[model samples]
Target: MTTNKSQDSLQQQLASLPQDVQPGRDLWQGIELAITQQPSATDKAKPKSWVYGAVAASILVPAVAVWISISSLSGPVEPGLDSAALIAQLSEQYESQKSSLLVTYQDKPALTDNWQSQLTELEDAAAAIKSALKHDPNNVALLRMLQTVYQQQIDLIERVHAPKWQQI
Candidate 1:
């Protein structure tokens, strides 16, 4: 019963309100004036030069810093430090190390049967990189990749032959 009375009161209040009430003044005139008026030069949005400069500096400063650091670290190449010679020297060392490791592990069976295949794959990759280096003997990236592959092969050989349990 109380809900019904409250609902009736709400309906009465809604009915008493004017449905078609008009504004005291016509709003279109003000709207039209605002729309037709040109914005003042000062009111128009301007690109802030300092903000752009700040943004550019934020990007450019780090880039320039990185380039400078890299250039400084690399320094000028020494005439005697030939890439081919370096590659050859490193390859000789790697082969010697690999041979020694194989000899050390010759009596031990590898933990994984597929380790030799994996090593073969790495050797293939190394061969490809070396071939690439031959075409571009001065390529540092290729040299690094070849070095990494050789290291990986060595690591794989060591890990498979010398299982962690055996170390303990």
Candidate 2:
């Protein structure tokens, strides 16, 4: 009879507790939204790829333009040697030859002042031969005559001036 009384008291305590303690929502609907609302993997890379492509094109276009402009500005043809260059070369040759002849004359001061005229004529002849030689570098007769004229003028100046350098 005591066991029966204890069992009754336990049942009465359980019946007195509250029954509305659990929270509620639609779990299936939440799972469907999470799975269906995400963007596709293929859609994520398009804008970044286009941005990189546009930047590369922008850099390449200006680089090609600059290269073309510089190429055009420099032009495509080689410049030819003009008459001034030839004349300057002849003048240089004449000066060098005359300087050598003048030194030779100065070394032997016994030469006549009249030899100056002959020296001038030899210089003129050398200039003429140089002009001709520019057109034909292999003209043997012209070169021989040019050398002969040069030597003749030198010999004449040496005869009129002091003895030859070896003799001195």
Candidate 3:
């Protein structure tokens, strides 16, 4: 009975609220500016295909960071499957993807200088973990760290190379 009364009261309160609130007159000018600033239709549509990859990459960044931190505190997982082959595969993928991005972006300047620096930092971190893995052989934390860094490198490259419509 109490829930039924509360539901009815909630409905009445919602019905009493105004529904016609609107933006001020200045909002249309910004909308016009945005429309005018839009790039060509072809250019606008090109990035849509890669946008899913970009979205996935964005989501991965936080998960990797959290995983890295958690794994660093915990003792390394047991040596099980062959991490060497996995690291090698990720490294090869990174190299090919990096080269492709470099070729693609050869004519264009990066959106910012910070992305390359960030990639360098991640690369350095991956190298450090790789060096440690050489000693530990199958250290799960190191394997995960190396994979995350490599994945981040590819993601950054894709992001910088892709069409940047939002910049407008």
Q: Considering every candidate listed, which one attains the maximal TM-score? A: 1
The TM-scores of all predictions, comma-separated, are 0.53, 0.35, 0.48
- Tell me the tens digit of each residue's lDDT in model 1 across 34-141: 999998886666656787688467435544543443343254555665667666766776787789779878998988899989999999999999899889776656
What would the per-residue lDDT of candidate 2 be over residues 29-74, giving only the tens digit for each residue?
8889988887877677446667667746743553454344334323
Best by lDDT: 1
Give the Cα lDDT of each candidate. 0.75, 0.58, 0.71
Better of 1 and 3 by lDDT: 1
The segments of candidate 3 whose C-alpha lies over 4 angstroms from its true place after superposition are 1-82, 163-168
Flag regions of model 2 displaced more than 4 Å: 1-111, 163-168
Clashes of 1: 0
lDDT of 1: 0.75
**Weakest 10 consecutive residues, lDDT, candidate 3?**
69-78
**Sort by lDDT, best first: what order?**
1, 3, 2
- lDDT string for model 3 (1-168, tens) is 999999999999999999998866668888889889968787965657577788677556555654554354357544564556656755765676668667867887777779889888988998898889889866666667776787778778767766456433
Sort by TM-score, best first: 1, 3, 2
